[model samples]
Target: MRLMALFAAFSLSVSAQSVTRAGLTVTYRDPADRGQLARVFTVWQKAAQDLKAKGLTLPPATLTASRNASDFASLTGYPAHIAAITLKGNIYTQRLAALHARNLLPYTLRHEAFNLAQPPDLPRWLAEGLARVFSGEAQKDPPERTGLETLSERELDTLLARASGLGLNRVYREATRRAAQRLKQQGWQETLTLTSR
Candidate 1:
């Protein structure tokens, strides 16, 4: 079925159930998810520390997980192919088990945390690019050629906001490359202060 049709077919809501450990709070609805927060708190800690060192200190944020992909897609209004999203300083994700099975749990945690903590006025393309770079996903991108560079910042942001699945991946890699280059040219603090008005 089509992605929008699939998203429109069902709707589910998240209930507030939470666990706090080592300065991190995780929210989830599944009974099976108990104790899983403890397992990943370290990743959050590391990402927080690393981002802080890079001049972006995060605020109080909760990492939330939906029990299944359908619920996640419905709640987030994003394609399930998208790993996670940050809204109002909270991270919402698909099932922890699914992310673990796919080895995306750590990267997702890091990436979304950056999104949560990023400067409020940061441009979308730069925000996404630096998020992946901060999460180390940028380093792992498979080399591929694309026309993304020719697009203006506004155009790139629009693409990043609308694309899903592989289309999202390509734009994301280009964004990462752009962000990394900018970071290299201007130091981290300078970049944040200059671009993140």
Candidate 2:
């Protein structure tokens, strides 16, 4: 009986409910934005579907512009956020920025969903890197030539000088090798944890 109780507790600790709201979940709070609710609803549904394709599920949530109502919302893009969190039979979340650019929302949803699934294990950098990679938005090449040239002229001149001696092909090859290693070791969970932070 004691073992069964412990097992139940352990299972409950890992799985939790998640809600995501974006767009006008907040605007509705103010009478003025009520008219925009339809637009917000349309966008929110599409965003949710996009996220679903990545294996992250969102429960029914209010889409709002006001940060207070959301568990998370983007300050820059669609001002959608979510607030309530029910974790392991308890609530866990406060307010946070959750929305992202239309193109990036799917990745962000997957990233956050992984954190919810694991709860307090994964690091942030790896999570974000994973999201970026999964979304096909990962940086495929080294920093742009413009940035490199600017750096050579303004700062890190010695480093740039050394780089100039190295063959471009060698640099590319080394980068590819490192990327593969990182992917093999981190996988999706580590990547999500890396970015969650």
Candidate 3:
């Protein structure tokens, strides 16, 4: 069954500049970005439902649209290459404009949403792979022909955590490949259930 039936309901808050509903809150720093923020909120409703249709329960999260690149990096402590991250019920991202410009708004939200909804104890390799797969981002990866499939889960986890640059991408690719294979053979809910232990 889709997780929409399972996602927990959350309380909401209302204000002049921020609005919360159905486990999500959209906020912006500048008045001028109101339109974009509203659009994000609207899109998020469906995004949540879509993920629900899979097996992830979208939690109550505050999505704060950072004003600029440096602000996003500062607030999230992530590189500019990172689109968004969900931490402690807060979703931080690049400016709505930047995301929209890069055509990354929806997938980025879905990717982070997958991360947010996953069980915290799941192995990093599996979790990252599943996040990319669930968000449909895995489909964007180039084909992998060598050097990663043989690694143990611990080794894969280490590479994913410590490797930077192209090495990181390779780890991501391998992880995604493994995750997709698992999903294809079993399914997301069961995959999550079995691998989490």
Model 1: ten consecutive residues of lowest lDDT: 7-16
lDDT of 1 by residue, 12-76 (tens): 23355788865678888765666567657888889889988987877777777887888888988
Between candidates 2 and 3, the lDDT winner: 3
Q: Which stretches of candidate 2 lie over 4 Å from their true place?
A: 1-27, 67-121, 126-197
Error of 2 at 117 (Å): 8.6
How does residue 128 of candidate 1 score in lDDT? 89
Off by over 4 Å in 3: 1-17, 30-32
Relative to the true structure, how large is the alpha-carbon lDDT of every model? 0.80, 0.38, 0.77
lDDT of 1 at 143: 79
TM-score, every prediction: 0.86, 0.31, 0.82
Better of 2 and 3 by TM-score: 3
With a 3 Å backbone cut-off (N, CA, C), the pairs that clash in candidate 1 are: none
Pick by TM-score: 1 or 3, better one: 1
Ranking of all predicted structures according to TM-score, beginning with the best and ending with the worst: 1, 3, 2
